[model samples]
Target: MANPHSDHPAHLQHHFVSSEQQFDAAKMGMWLFLVTEILLFSGMFVAYIVYRTWHPEVFAKSAELLNPFLGGLNTIVLLASSFTVALGIHYAQKDNKKGLVINLVLTFLFALTFLVVKYFEYTAKFEHGVFPGAAFDPHGVSHGVDYATYNIPYARQFFSIYFVMTGIHGFHVLVGMGLFTWITIRALKGEFSSAYYTPVENCGLYWHLVDIIWIFLFPLLYLI
Candidate 1:
């Protein structure tokens, strides 16, 4: 007799001979997607490094103004979320539906917290006349003695890149939040099982890619 487990309804896929074949194909596709994403972010990182090198004094000054504490806290939040996402995938593979749901929810919460902190950081900058591009105005540049020492234009350039880079990164976080929400809904509905959770697994891979980007961004933008 055919193995009962092999007869799972999830075993059928229009383009594959078995669920295993479909799972492997999906995993491969997701990895390829992540590779492209890395290349996209690499362009931005290169631009940032080049500009910073060209204006080291300004870059260092801007870095000083950034609250390392907020950046550090967000970093910890993302790392913890990544851990929960990993556990969620592990439990999903084991067909532990409840555990998967719980972990996914925790991941969503962390993402929300990250955005909340980011909002305050951006708002504070704006209030200090740290707007990007032409809107930027250093109130002290015209009055303070220190302004007579450091070049002002260079400072504006640093803030411009800072806003653009972090703004783009924050957009990615929003995308990840949407993905988590979709996967959580499906998991709660019992749409995933040990036999066919490749979609969930693939989504987890995407989330991991986002987390990895933040890892590089943190040190590059804030620490150095």
Candidate 2:
């Protein structure tokens, strides 16, 4: 009798004993990456806590300048994108290439929409002189709102953390978009199937993480 493992897929590496092993290894690696990501974000979260503790009023007042409506809309967009990525992985596991492709495309579009909204938000902030650090100067009527009122002490800290955290999250969104684009093209070319869909699964995991980060961000930076 021939070895059943002899017909392993082309993408399988020689080091992996079986496709199951390869998938497990990929998942382990992703988890490790996620751990590092969590640690990285944890430092920023700690900073936010420390500053907010010291200057709660400033932080609260500064947060009012942020448009919660836009933030909520972006939150919805990211949540929807997370759902589409999950659906993509489901279709990939079911060997439904067309469904996978469609979901991936939708996920990318949702991500793009999020960034577009963010672009407008950032532009409004810049126009209002809501910059970080020593350049922090809110003086002028932009968006028909006077930003000079927001020029409270330590308010820069809040905006700085807001920008850094959300900026990093947005960067992840862009990265997820690239990953989905690659996976979508592969799906269109019949690269994924029930037998070999590790890429889709891994990318879905990444997309979900990005969405999760934004979920945390929306409330911390907008609602709370």
Candidate 3:
């Protein structure tokens, strides 16, 4: 921690001249990292579009085996978690530690809810043998829905794509939960304030990216 400023903040690193500079630099870095994440997912999206274009029926039919209700529920949970993260950042900016801590905890809980819902969704899919690649073998029927009926040609490709795309997205959600947990602990320790809440802000941006990715994922994997 090198400090040139006689009034330099403790959190401000030695390399940065001012807190504003550090904040801007961090934000720019986060955006750049997010761009990489977008590119990473974009390749998968392109693959999906190409495959779907080649076999629209296969994709549509394969989608039937998916539980849109669970997907929609997880979407709502992630959106709410993003909102909570935003609120946490707002409270941090206002120097309201209690508000910030509460919101961070809430955000963590929402993230946990998302993962829990996703767990059930994954388990149900597994129960039906709806796995990726060669392992795919949709079978059985608990209700009126027959999983065996969904075993169409190129359907394996659709499930593979579904698992890959959603699987990566789910991994991000898990990471976000970890991030929120760490941030919540820091918030409780009173490490953040208006003068320096960069971690809180950065974590919020990452969570927003996670939610945005899922927004694209839900429609591509579930509805359409």
Best by TM-score: 3
Q: What is the lDDT of residue 167 in candidate 3?
A: 86
Cα shift from native, residue 27, model 1 (Å): 1.4
What is residue 139's positional error in candidate 2, in angstroms?
1.6
Better of 1 and 2 by lDDT: 2
Local lDDT at 51 for model 1: 83
Per-residue CA lDDT of candidate 1, range 9-91, in tens? 65466567777888899899999999998998888888888888897777777676677889999999999999999999899
Badly placed stretches (over 4 Å) of model 1 are 1-8, 140-151
lDDT of each: 0.83, 0.89, 0.90
* Model 1 C-alpha lDDT versus the unseen true structure: 0.83
Which residue runs does candidate 2 get wrong by more than 4 Å? 1-6, 142-144
lDDT of 2 by residue, 11-95 (tens): 8888999889999999999989988888888898999999989998898888889999999999999999999988988888888
Model 3: per-residue Cα lDDT at residue 41:
94
